[model samples]
Target: MDGIEDGAQPKKKKGMVMTIAAIAIVSVVGAGGGWFLGGMLAPEPLSSDEARVLEEAKATIKAREAAEAAHEAAPAGGEHGDAKKDDKDGLPKASTEANGVLQLDPITTNLSYPTENWIRLELALLFQGKPDVAMAEQIHDDVAAYLRTVSLQQIEGPRGFQYLRDDIQERVDLRSEGRVTNVIFRTFVVQ
Candidate 1:
């Protein structure tokens, strides 16, 4: 019986070694296959045209940065310097009136529900004929007032944004009495 048990122990050890060897071989093959597939499926190098466009974009960005730096370094006392100074955010100020379009001053107000959250909107109204400054001011005030009543949830998604746009358009039409043909949303930000 003792001899039989000792012989059985060697067979058990051999079986365990075979199982480990099989696992190792499978793991190595799997890793090699994965590496080969990854190389095969890798994205191709950018074409010459794509590379040129990328370089051009980089150059344009660098030029813009240098121009901005130069502008910043220059004295602020030119004809447009007052306008630049007036712009608190350093961006180019939109003209209030140009042709039949009249841009309203940016409207910033807190949300009704969450008072901490605020909305900033810049809108341009396109008039059918001559732009009415009085009507435009009234519309701007109305829009600002309307926005104050809005909640974060009211303008959360694309559909909500569309609804807000529609509401503003309708309000502008009512306030302008059909004088305002379109309301171009220049900027809309909520924070």
Candidate 2:
């Protein structure tokens, strides 16, 4: 009986030791699994300020894209060709006496006073049909010569220039035998 009891004691001790080893193995596996999961699920760390700035940058980019799309989709007449075409067609076409506007290059003249300055004067003639090319060249030459004769003092002020323009129109009308009715200035430069 004594021998049996001692043997049973040894068996009980071995069972307890096995149970402890199993529990330890389970704890180690659980810890390793938790570490792996943490690595997979963890988010990148960012300061609050940095996060706010990133959000604002994203918003700004989206807003600019939206604005650009809107601008492209809508018609902007001021910057487009349709507006210019409309302006040209909207003007009342000149009558049989004056069919359309004739654009002419300005005659540039050098002034000999105070400073070495230059003046440019443009002219637009209203006439019926396309005038003969030779006649137009002759008219241009005659007008340029006439402009060369004008004194600097006579065309110094706005009123003086206006009168000069009117006088030039009248002279052109006379030269063309009433065929040219009006003159419009396309560009004027005094520098």
Query: Candidate 1, which segments miss by more than 4 Å at Cα?
Result: 1-98
Candidate 2 RMSD computed on C-alpha atoms after optimal superposition onto the true structure: 29.4
Candidate 1, position 26, lDDT: 100
**lDDT values, one for every candidate:** 0.83, 0.68
lDDT of 1 by residue, 16-117 (tens): 999999999999999999999998977567799977876886687579668767876777666755753433345443443435777787787889966756
Query: Which stretches of candidate 2 lie above 4 Å from their native place?
Result: 1-98, 111-115
Q: Estimate each model's TM-score.
A: 0.52, 0.44
By summed lDDT, which 10 consecutive residues of candidate 2 come out lowest? 88-97
